[model samples]
Each structure stands twice: as C-alpha cells, then as structure tokens.
Target: MYNPNELLTRFRKYLQAEQLAKSTVEQYCCMTKYFLNYHKCGADRISTSQIISYLVTISSPVSRKQARAAIAKLYFMLGNHQKMNKVPAHVGFYAG
Candidate 1:
C-alpha cells in the first residue's frame, strides 16, 4: 500500500490547501518526489536518520537546507509528526 505516486498527489493537494505560494508548492513537490525516488520506499518507512543521511550528501548549503525543509514539510503532511518535529529548521550545514 505504499504507492509513491498516490502519496505525491496527496502531498500536492495538501500544499495547495495550505495556500503555499505556487513556486514553493512546485519546489516542495519536486523535492518530495526526488526524496521518494531516492529512498525507493514508503514514506512511512523512511527514518529520520535516513533523511539526515541524504541531506549530508548534498554539497550545496542552500540546496541541503531547501531539501531539509521540503522533507520536513512532506513528513508533516504525511502525518509523521515525530519525524517532522525532529527536522530542524536550520540544520548546521557547516558541521561535518
């Protein structure tokens, strides 16, 4: 029952319902899809550590931060409140 495409559609609707700006909605959706593809697993199965591990691989600070934000929002929309709460708004990208 872990259909990435279906979850993605719901996520898009959630973002629009939340009244996110069009560009923000697009960015979030794109990042969410990328995350889904990268993990290749159900969103419910993605762990907090997995998310952090992915973020660590992004070389650009801006991109890493954006992806983190997107992941957090996506997790929240997916009802993973614990993981969403754990995703810091500003992860120390400088800290290796």
Candidate 2:
C-alpha cells in the first residue's frame, strides 16, 4: 500500500542524500514518477519484465537509457536488490 507521492518524496530525498546533481535528481524523479504512474502499481510489486516493457516504449535511446537508470536507482532505494540487478544494461542499438 505505498502512496506514490510519498514514495516519490522519499526518493527525491534519497537521491539528494546520494549527492546526485540537482538536474540528475530531478530527471530521475520525473522518470520514476512516470514509471510508477504507467504501471499504477505499488513500487514493491514492480517486476523486471514490467520495467523492460516500459523501457521498450520509450522511442529515444537516450531517454530510454535515462529511464532505465532512474528505475534501477528507484529499486535500489527501495532495497529491492534483486529487481535492481535485473534491470538490463543499455543496448547500443536502437531501431527507432
């Protein structure tokens, strides 16, 4: 029963605590929020397959890479090491 807004607030604080650049934190939070809203599910319930599915929907390679990184970081902050590990690395090829 995670509240998305609360989760996002904590995530923002976590990113700041990690010393990420301000823009990077903002970008990551925005991407993470988009992912959360897309799934409409609790963060703990998100799976690697869902993450991959969402990543595939992004048309831009750069944006996809950033979203992947953001989602991975979100899972890391949630202490879900397994999900974090399952996030795929960026592929060099983009067909779109």
Candidate 3:
C-alpha cells in the first residue's frame, strides 16, 4: 500500500531541492494533504476528477486558485502530471 506521509516527505524534499520558499512548501503540502484526505487515497491514485471535486468545494476564489496551484505542484513532484499553464482541457475548468 502507498503511504501518503512517505510520499509527502519525498515531496517536501523535492520542494527543498527545487529551492522553493519554506512558506510556499508548507502551503503546498497542506493543500496536498487536504487533497489526499478528500479522496481517501494515496497520492499516486489521485485523479483529475477528484482534483476538480476538491477545488469546487473551496468557497473562496483565492483559496481555490491557491489549492489548484498546490495540487499542481504536488503532481509535478510526483513526476506524472505536467506544467500548470498547460493543464489539459478537461482540467482547465478548475485551473482558475
């Protein structure tokens, strides 16, 4: 079974390696954790639909955008998802 904490630890390391600011890393990780919790699944199993659903639940536009960016960063760290600006058409709705 995939462990979210282990994956998130790797994500934190990846953020450090990329030289992201400490606060930025924290925010991103927090949003990613929320995402993981919402889906009740491992990071590797997170889907585009799940991401959209999570974003939709955020009432604040600013928070919604931030969460979207954070999820994108997490996906980038995992090495499966692509750049944020170039997210697929299906994901554009939640990109904000």
Per-candidate TM-score against the hidden true structure? 0.63, 0.66, 0.61
Model 2 C-alpha lDDT per residue in residues 18-93, reported as the tens digit of each score: 9999988987887766666665543434556566567556523435567777877877777666635443332111
Can you give the lDDT of residue 65 in candidate 1?
64
Question: Number of clashing pairs, model 3?
Answer: 0
Cα RMSD of all models vs. native, in order, equals 9.0, 9.2, 7.8
- After best superposition, candidate 2 residue 31: deviation in angstroms? 0.6
User: Which sections of candidate 1 miss by over 4 Å?
Assistant: 41-62, 84-96
Clashing pairs in 3: none
As a TM-score, model 2 comes out at 0.66
lDDT (Cα atoms) of all candidates against the true structure: 0.63, 0.65, 0.60
lDDT tens digits, residues 1-96, model 3? Answer: 336677678778888888989987887776666665655533434456557557657523336566776767776765646655433433211110
Off by over 4 Å in 2: 41-62, 83-96
Task: Give the lDDT of residue 36 in candidate 1.
Answer: 60
